[model samples]
Target: MKAALSSVPEKQQQDSEFLREVLEGLGGKRKTLPCKYLYDEVGSRLFEDICEVGDYYLTRTEASIFANNLRDIASEIGRDALLIEPGAGNCEKVEALLAVLESPRGYYPIDISPEILLDAERRIKANLPEMQVWSEVGDFTQPGVWDRLSMIPSRKRVVFFPGSTIGNFEPEKAEELLEMFAANLGTGDGLLIGTDLVKDSVRLERAYHDSEHVTEKFNKNLLSRINSELGADFDLSLFAHRAFYHQLRKRVEMHLVSLKKHSVSIADTRVDFSEGETIHTENSHKYSVSDFNQLLARGGFRPICHWKDSADSYAIHYAQAI
Candidate 1:
């Protein structure tokens, strides 16, 4: 059965917000772009390609952790528990987890894109014939999602947040997001989070700046999206992809550098770029297990236990809401 997608009524606001953010970010002294805008339908497809790129180890590494520790992870989650993945948990990942869950109550996978969420719903239901699934599509942080979650009845609700996506949030926002997850959870509810650990800068840099250049395309797609949607005139050939690891900040930053001086007009707005000027796009933050535990504490969660891969390049942690 196809699960009904709980749509957030934001279709009207999405485009206007995108344009506004693009204008605002571009006008700033240090030119930057919203990272979320990089996941349009086109960009989303490119991201799927990114996951398959050989240098992008985060996906494969986390998969190995789950594959190796599925039983133990399931035991921690307990029986008849409702599993909620806040964002981006695909059908295959959810099905794999559900396979080992002890009489799982249901699964709620929320994402902003209807295209992906609906497809995920079909695939998940196809695989788990009897599983209860509620897929929501929209900004998961909004009140609509909060209500949707609190309304569901279950013995335990565990937010299965994987993929080290939380690493993308700034520390303050990370704590706020965790607190939001904590607020949605009742007593005994859990946050199963995965994070990319701090590692050698060389490996970290290569992960984002892959040899296959898929990451480059992933980064450049933002410009293509802006050009297509906002009526912006950007020559994709004039921009080059740049990514590097910042060891002190423990993050990898992605940017698009202008190869020559230019001005791209977007719906009557002229944004100027100098030769070698860059538009900061995204950052993937890494964390040590202890540092993340401290973050969880601030975010109203108590770390229970964590699972790590053989080399400790990544970690999956289970935390209880305080």
Candidate 2:
């Protein structure tokens, strides 16, 4: 079987990368890990479930904005633009936009998962056979991953990032990423992004710590992944998920706490855990509308138009590289 191949460099690359990141994070003084690791197939599926939960309104609110404003967005983007979406996930958001854009030169959906990318490509190809579907499997955070957008001649480039995923990045890092977008995209190129706005702490807390415990499973899945990929002894039952909004940081932080003092050996490294100790898993930073606009300006983007739900719970901003 293709999966039985024992000598693939890509397979080795993922394992090596996971091992390196785990060791560094576990050894760090803060005992924190990167949120990006939480997207193994199961984690990804859990996230999809989180979106449907009534408490989690980011997806629903943003979807409403798109539904009401897709035509205006498409008009600004114009026709024959190369639509490039980083972290394309299941490509549902891009699909909505594609429906409105007239005669796009190509549809390039980029994601870290090859399986998801292939599925997205198949669906898009089946639905919109007239447009080119060039799906790629790679990390979009890296510098040159987006260089391909320039290759398709005579088409303006448009970068689409939805799902309030930008909240995952710390502010400074977010600015850096937006600047990278500006650098990669040509003059007059547009960037469409969705972001969660700061709101009631209770509602925000409930969104991450959902009633069905799906979010808990999603957070704990990171350890399961580490155990599977690296030879690690992670007794999943000994850890519990916890999420809370940190008002000072304007972010909701998720952690996996140890129920009892324990130790786990990851490869040759043994990491000790004290009772009640935590491994910080993820942070979703909420932003005020004006604060986010300042961030976009710092990233060399000028916000041209935006749409938000009546409650102002979320935002979809269309900005251009300045």
Candidate 3:
């Protein structure tokens, strides 16, 4: 099984940009790294485990809502539209949607990791032999990342952004990304997005800090990845994964706390850690349907239709380019 994979031709520049970002993040006051880096092979597998864990309800709930509302959502998507999914991890939810979507011209599952992206594309093609799969390896947040969509021949385009991944960004940055999506599509094009709604604090917290320890392993894998890729000496056992909901911020914060005072060196960079000091890894902001709609508007999208599961645990919205 083969799939057309598109990646930036400039490998040297890509590496330079990665090292620069890592330096900027580690040297900052908060000491952080982009969550995107966490999707390396091992990290990706750990995340798949997280979605299935008992406490993590987002994935299962979202899939249920999509399944129930598949027909209605397909109506809004219309026929022969090109389906482009950003952060298309494993292409799981999209496969369910493809089962019902009317002859989509093509399916583009874009992700940052090439190995996982191609593997996912192959699986998707195997499942739906007739469907066209074009997977790309690049950061979808970059300004010109959507330029390749223009090369796909289709009158209508639907950007499928499920997994509530938008919550990973600050509201301001989320709006900026939505605006980028708006600029990429023509009038009447759609953005079919899944967002986790604000809910009980305890439930939200548990979803990230799962009892199975899968999320913990997933969080710590970032350090393991850095050590492997950048020649860093990080004793993974020296740090513990910590995640909790910040009531004031209305988001789940993930941190890798130093078990005790320690220091690590990466390439030519030296970073010192204090006992209990943490490197913030990711933030997932929960939202009310109203808050999300306002956010969509700010990004130049108008929510035309939406659906929520029986428990209202999650929502799938269909918005049009304004």
- Model 1, span 1-322: residue lDDT tens: 2334333554447778889999999999999997877776677778878888899999899999999999999999999999988766354566788978999999888776778877787887788888888787766666576577667788999988888889888889899999889888887789999999999999988889999999899898998888887889999999999999988889999999999998999999999999999999998999999999999999999999999999999999999998
TM-score of each: 0.95, 0.96, 0.95
Residue 287, model 3, lDDT = 90
**Model 3 per-residue lDDT tens digits across residues 24-97:** 89888889988888887798888999999999999999988877888999999999989988888788878878
Q: lDDT of candidate 2 vs native?
A: 0.86
Task: Please list the residue runs of candidate 3 whose C-alpha ends up more than 4 Å from where it truly belongs after superposition.
Answer: 1-11
Candidate 1 is scored at a TM of 0.95
For candidate 2, list the clashing residue pairs, or say none.
none
Worst 10 residues of 3 by lDDT: 1-10
How many clashes show up in model 3? 0
